[model samples]
Target: MSETHVPARRVVVIGGGISGLAAAHRLVDGGAQVTLLEASGRLGGKLYAGQIAGVAVDLGAESMLARRPEAVNLARAVGLADRLCLPAASAAGLYTRGALRPMPTGHVMGVPGDVAPLAACGVLSDAGLTRIGRDAELPRDELGEDVGIGTYVAARLGREVVDRLVEPLLGGVYAGDAYQISMRAAVPQLYEAARAERSLTEGVRAIQRRAAAGPAAGGPVFMGIDGGVGGLPLAVADAVRAGGGDIRTHAPVRRLARTGSGWSVVTEDGTALTADAVVVALPAPAAASLLAADAPGAAAELGTVEYASMALVTMAFRRAEVAGLPNSRGFLVPSVDGLTIKAATFSSHKWGWVAQGDPELFVLRTSVGRYGDEADLERDDPELVARSLADLHTTVGLTARPVATRVERWDGGLPQYPVGHLDRVARVREQVAGLPGLRVCGAVYDGVGIPACVATAHTAADELLGLLATVPAA
Candidate 1:
């Protein structure tokens, strides 16, 4: 193993999303030659921000919860700590039964922890409230593995809670259908608490007590950059470049094949790059296509993980024009409401600086999540926009039309963590371990939030770096 006879190993990372960027940055910091390839021209995959009427408008995730430290830590690592802005203190609403009602306080994922709020909110009928109040005394299940959120909530708190409250709140956060999402995967803490205390209500109270004793449980309020969340990704890209890592846009990876000693990554442009190790930090489908032959079982399993399409329709209007809308953060519509829009965020109200003029231009970010409904996704952009506006007007009494509108369609934006998702992820992990010099990291495995992606990338980077250190130098 003489120095002249040994060859330096290069690591190539596919995808330029936050996960890929984080992995590449970590590898470069560990003295490895790294090249990041992104199919799209832009760096951030889902994080997009732009200016409208002299105000920054975010089309992707508006902000990340500070309680989740991964995104916050990554931002600080990339010199973005000074740019963080917390959302204003305000309540959110729920659109149910053709009316916008205030969300009951002391709720964890729309599950009532305190009975007083649920009793007074009027979002639930007297019968529904009585049924929910009985959950504290309901018979407990001792041996439940992974159950659907709908089944778990409905069984314990009655069907009304699941349909009108829990479904919409969780669906809005995950962009998923409640009937399919796993209680274990989506809200493990809630499940754990239920198992421990044998009552959902009591479990929440215990967790709240623990949180109050500690340094605030929900972390910092949802925080975004002054410019927008896009700034965070841009900052990460800059840091990667500054650390001597190459990031190539418009470089779509076609396939990954293991070679005699390392690997060969073929690009869509018919170019191939050789690397000692490769990290596939992409959406599950994209990653599956690349690893189909090299890791068939893993690829097949990855393909089983489905994704949902969505569109964000951002409309800006004068404050007086929509005066009837409550001064809340936003509102979510239950599926029972049969609304085209799943939820809408009062962007200007959430943050103080988002408004532009004397009339206080308000930005409403409306989301349309299409899980199994291809017809919903097929609607024309204009038609979709019109329907969304109509829904908003009818729900919140808007007097004027939007002065400016922007629509962003994500064909496969959200990954759905169906029941047994944890088991599937475990199988994928096992398969990946059998393949040497290959790693997979993204939202598909664990969570679908900014923090989860960062955590996955960091963990993958650590594994890859350890493998690199053990390889004989060429």
Candidate 2:
């Protein structure tokens, strides 16, 4: 390939979220002609930056995993790298057993390395502590090819560990049941180590040691932009256009079909664009519908993928009313608490930039609803906010009235990766591989975080470009 070799491939990307934007950016950056279509009027599906009480903050996804370089790299490529910022506070709390206790250390997603720390944390009862002691003595069981995170962890550490420690952390991320979420897909490193070590505690210790040796182990786990994560998509989309890619909002892809050596993508408005390759970076359901005609197996598998709906209630309160608030970042409520809200983040305390805009005003957000439990979302916005405020008063001693409130609802925000998710992804890829120039990527197929979506998009873009490289130029 020449240094300035321009590929004859015209790639059509369907979807307007970060995944699609990243794919388009990669394709265009690779010197390929591209056309990007989005169903919505604006880009950045789950990431939106908005103002509450004249203070700018992220109304959607606030941060990205810094350990993974895809998101950070994309930010740099789009000229927002210098704007990245870390959280002001790192420690988080767990509201369980009628008190707000410190989260345990030396664990990965509630999987503990030593039982003493868990006992010290007081999140567990005396009975739970007793069970943790007997964990290592338990007989070794047959390890399966794949299993649920709750099933495997509960079996080794007992139900108390899974309920108190594991569930809350996992719930905060997946918004799904621990027993149904895939151990392999959700936390593959720990699950894979569990297969090698007979004792789960020992396995976790080994995993921790390996992490400690790695360069990124003790570094800040997450990062956010100075403005908001929502700005990331817009910057990348701008870069895509600057690279000569055509990006159109409200151009939802209606039909995608193979045309001889290339593919033809039709928009909802009946506009057709023929391209040498096609990348479908969308939700599982939407991707399934578009791929049903050509890759029925993949489509069927995609259709089986489930999702979890959630709502975020952002509230701004007078600073004096929350004077005696906890100094930590936030607190997570386990389902066992029977609380309407699952988690809450103190935005003003967590992000210094959010506070810089208004020091006298305190801002926070509470998340409601999950995979199988969405009754909380059915209530009106006022009802949800009242419940959240009530819980905050009880948990952290807040007696404040909000100056402003914003409620954002995501019907199917998170895709539930059930057991055998990795295997299912493999099958989908195998089926799609049979097609010459078709590919799929997004939160549905790979990881759900911002970095994971970007990484998947880059992979899809590379795959399509590779296929085009093999073809003879027109």
Candidate 3:
């Protein structure tokens, strides 16, 4: 008997970010013919690699959580395994109380697991420290449905903890206000702990104990590429092409429609691409615009998702000029501190590759702006640099001029996850799932981290592979 040969499934992935690249790589691996469409001239979305003062550095996102296997595994699959590097300096500090204080240990995202360590850090005032202890004495507070991280934590630990400790840490991730961010979506472990335990501090300690016992306990918390984390996307894109996937840049997808047996993706120049499966890997807004016709419910939910804009001011200074700079990784500034710059990373100190790239040049970057607080983003690049310098001077007493500077602004860079965000995501997925050969994945859905984005992309691709397996290939 003669065996039948199945034709390859045609898959189209919208957006050229890490999510899209990852999806394309997985789809190609599944024996599908994939085409990746990127609206921009480049592939990496937030992961951007650039140079200053003849030294290579990351202009966008710099690191990924090492505990998450998705991103690191993807990097290994893309030939970057040998290039992986760990952080040179892991200790980070908080710039508050008119000084740079060490980040407190025994906390889960700024929620104190032990009062001794929290008090030792001194990020919070004496009264704030006392307020955290009260969490153990308070009556059991039910965390019904979903609640804001800031609102729930403040009720137990007071606003001082939320402002001084929580805000800066969460801001580093989402660039969002702590009071409005979703507890379930942002920190699910803490949310579950709060539900089971009355004392928030004990709940946090339980979490810490579990983490210590876990396999990832002694592992590095974060990982960086030898050159820059930004290079991951480029490497993934290269792998996709090597796997015979067609990747296109400057190919802005204008519309998407459900065809009789599959989907049709039309680009800005009116180029139509037919696909047996489609993965919408763009940001929330872009995904909303494309899904409006076929998946209106998902489109509406995506439209409701808000974003935060921020700018990164990268400066390279003479090593001799910045000797007074702190030897630690860097410091985060709380919004309550009334600072223009939110956080600063001592790149040369934090990444060994950066220091090795240029012995005489010291590089660092300062982030500015967040949700509902972006007036400083309107400032010119020079002014942003000056503002960063001023903040650095105030915090570290640095009064040196930079040899090279670059400002990178990301408008609508981060998605805000308010209360009920997980429900919103579920609804979107449910609606999209109804449409055969259609899936969505991005930072706007699972998480803003590189690993989360890659994980979502892999899930989307694997689902499409299964769906396409049942379809009659053309």
Candidate 4:
């Protein structure tokens, strides 16, 4: 990505989400002129925090994986370290067989390293438990480099484990079918171990041992901000401005093309901005559209990528109205259970800040829709809210209706990592590499976690910096 000798390098980041914000900030910090463009009126994409019944709450993602330093480190770098907070209770449960069962530990993506808990908890039937015991004795034969997580786990363990345990856990993350999700892309540690170890349990045990040896291994798995995870992008944008970068919302980039010694970005409003380098931090579809003419091969591959959409319905109720709420954080439902709602979180019970201002208002959230379940989200807000309350009533036995409800629909929110997704992404990058001073970074590429996205932003910025290294000063 090296550039020819030039003076006063300018950069245009075509997105205002967290990743775009990170890129713009990095360019500014490098003394490069930067301009950030966002299509919507708001800055944060899925990291939105708003109010419900006068109590502040997050309508999108509320927490982030703390073990990954990309997100937390960036938060601290943007002067938001003081606002960091951890979840009150990290314990979770699985709502299946019409009851809540404790989530078994010592597993990576619900692939239990120890099966004793599964036997005692009755998460799997007696016959299902018997199948698990046969894992160690299975044939030590050929397992491909990239295989479906559910298919491989079921072959080693059993179908019951994949359906009952692994399915729900993976579903909560990608909202895609487990049998089609890539093991290499989704869970690399487990995939790496499976290559050498004959037994899946043994492989998981080895991975856990390596993780526990890390510096921050024993701490809570996830964390949140004082207000919400949304504060992250807001703070980063402020830092970008402070460092002399321009951020424009409602300015969508429509196309990208190479200039004499730089790149040009065309916005929806017919605004043309040329820069020494450009970093595309957008979803696969949108990115593909802009790059169709410049990098058609990459665009074609990006067009093949699939996405899953879901809705988060936040509801607040009077504490007295919903009596006897449990101390647990949340519960997840398996798709096999034939339920409308996939998961629900007791927000007030999970976050201390949300519970601080309103002692009487108990806030909670319900998630609906998955890879193949978009019908539920199409329903009106009242219908979706009703279905969510019904699921709560059926499982937790809650009778009170919500005093305040907010519905946030994220269409095509999570990018699906189907089998061979990583290879496809590699090809996309390879195709784009032929074009100088142009790079793509977003949740669609490396990972969907906040940390992964930020790290990708850094990588893209470094690529741009690599180009700037060759430019000559006037």
Best by lDDT, which number?
Answer: 3
In model 3, what lDDT does residue 338 have? 91
Q: For model 4, what is the error of residue 460's alpha carbon versus the real structure, in angstroms, after optimal superposition?
A: 0.4
Q: How close is candidate 3 to the true structure, as a TM-score?
A: 0.98
Clashing pairs in 2: none
Per-candidate TM-scores read 0.94, 0.98, 0.98, 0.97
Pairs that clash in candidate 4: 5-472, 6-472
Which residue pairs show backbone clashes in model 3?
none
Q: How does model 4 score by TM-score?
A: 0.97
What ranges in model 4 sit over 4 Å off? 1-7, 472-474
Tens digits of per-residue lDDT, candidate 2, 1-474, equal 112333657889999899999988988877899889999999999989999999998989999999998999899999997899999989999999999999998788998878788878898889877877777898876778789999988888788888888888999888999988888899988887888877788888989888889999778899999988999999999999998899999888899998777888999899988888889989999999999999999999999999999999999989988889898889999998888889999999999989997999999999999889998889999998999999998898888889899999999999999999999999999999898888889998778999999989989888777767778532
Report how far residue 249 has shifted in candidate 2, in Å: 0.5
Model 1 worst lDDT run, 10 consecutive residues = 1-10
Worst 10 residues of 2 by lDDT: 1-10
* lDDT of model number 3: 0.92
Please give the CA lDDT of all the candidate structures: 0.81, 0.89, 0.92, 0.87
Better of 1 and 4 by lDDT: 4
lDDT of 1: 0.81
**RMSD versus native structure for model 3:** 2.5
